[model samples]
Target: TQLLEQSPQFLSIQEGENLTVYCNSSSVFSSLQWYRQEPGEGPVLLVTVVTGGEVKKLKRLTFQFGDARKDSSLHITAAQPGDTGLYLCAGPTNTGNQFYFGTGTSLTVIP
Candidate 1:
């Protein structure tokens, strides 16, 4: 089974600040994806990176896939209070049918 891990499980920052969250694994994946969720709501897909070294940007948020496909990162610029949420990274496991999600990063952007 492929296992995914995230670093700095939690983060709190003031509005207009910037932050980066990382997701890592020893197992290579076919694709990597990022999501953000708010309380009492389901996670929302932000972006998906399918190729090594791929980068996708959604407004002030940027997503990247490592060259080896074993890691990924999400960077948020000029964060807003609305950005406060749970961030997650996920990818298909070796089984292909199952997916593995990182521990997650809880970000609180204070106004």
Candidate 2:
């Protein structure tokens, strides 16, 4: 079974702070995606990494895929109140009919 687990189930930070969240799994994935979601809205894709050791940066956010393809990371710099939301990491399951979402990391950035 392929499963992804995220750490620090919740985080609260003041504006301008920085933080990192982790996603790990025992199974390898062909590709992994990071998404940020706001209340009552579907998750928006932040990035996708298909190669080991791949790194992609979007503004103040950075994402990395593990060399083994079994882990990933998300780093936020100079966080703002707008960054408050749920961050999720997901990958297509072996069956290909489902996407496995991580435990989820909820971040709150206070102004």
Candidate 3:
């Protein structure tokens, strides 16, 4: 079965610290979606990189797709308290009806 796994389930750092999150899987996916969610609200789409070797950046965040489409990485620069949230990676299969979400990464940026 295809599954997405994330490392460093929890992270706490200073306001200006930088961090990187990882998403890995053994199965290939048609598309991979990245989301940042706050408590009590649904996850909001951050970036979706479907093609292998694709890289996209938003403001202070950078996302990269693995050449094999089986892994991804998210790097955040100059972290702030407002940037604290749950980061999730989802991989959609051919059916497109379901998605495999990563274990989830909880980040806390202390002021």
Candidate 4:
């Protein structure tokens, strides 16, 4: 089974600061998705990338897929305290429709 991996497992930054998080995998997926999760709520999908080198922006956040389609990144410009949450990247596995999630990144944006 293939697995997704994330870097900088934990991040703490002050408000108005910028930060970047990464997700990587050796296996290529049909599509990759990014999610933001709060303490007690299910993850909310932020963006999905299906094409290699595709880039998407939402407000102050930018999402990018690697040219090889085996990696992804999220960058936040002037992060706010409300942005604190767990970031996850997920993609379907080789077998069936099962999806695998990355080793999550915990972000704490201090006000």
lDDT per prediction? Answer: 0.92, 0.94, 0.92, 0.93
Residues 31-107, candidate 4, lDDT per residue (tens digit)?
Answer: 88999999999999999988999999999999999999999999999999999999999997767388899999999
Model 3: per-residue Cα lDDT over 7-111, one tens digit each: 779999999889999999999987799999999999999999989989999999999999999999999999999999999999986899988899989999999
Worst 10 residues of 4 by lDDT: 91-100
Worst 10-residue stretch by lDDT in candidate 1?
A: 1-10
lDDT of 1 by residue, 1-111 (tens): 428899779999999999999999998999998989899999999989999999999999999999999999999999999999999999986677987888999999999
Which pairs of residues collide in candidate 2?
Answer: none
Greater TM-score among 2 and 4 belongs to 4
Candidate 4 Cα deviation (angstroms), residue 28: 0.9
> Candidate 2 lDDT, tens digit per residue, 1-111?
328899889999999999999999999998899999999999999999999999999999999999999999999999999999999999997787889999889999999
Instruction: Name the top lDDT candidate.
Output: 2
Once fitted onto the true fold, the runs of candidate 2 whose alpha carbons sit more than 4 angstroms away are none
Candidate 2, TM-score vs. the true structure?
0.94
How do the predictions measure up, each by TM-score? 0.94, 0.94, 0.95, 0.94
RMSD of each: 1.5, 1.5, 1.3, 1.5
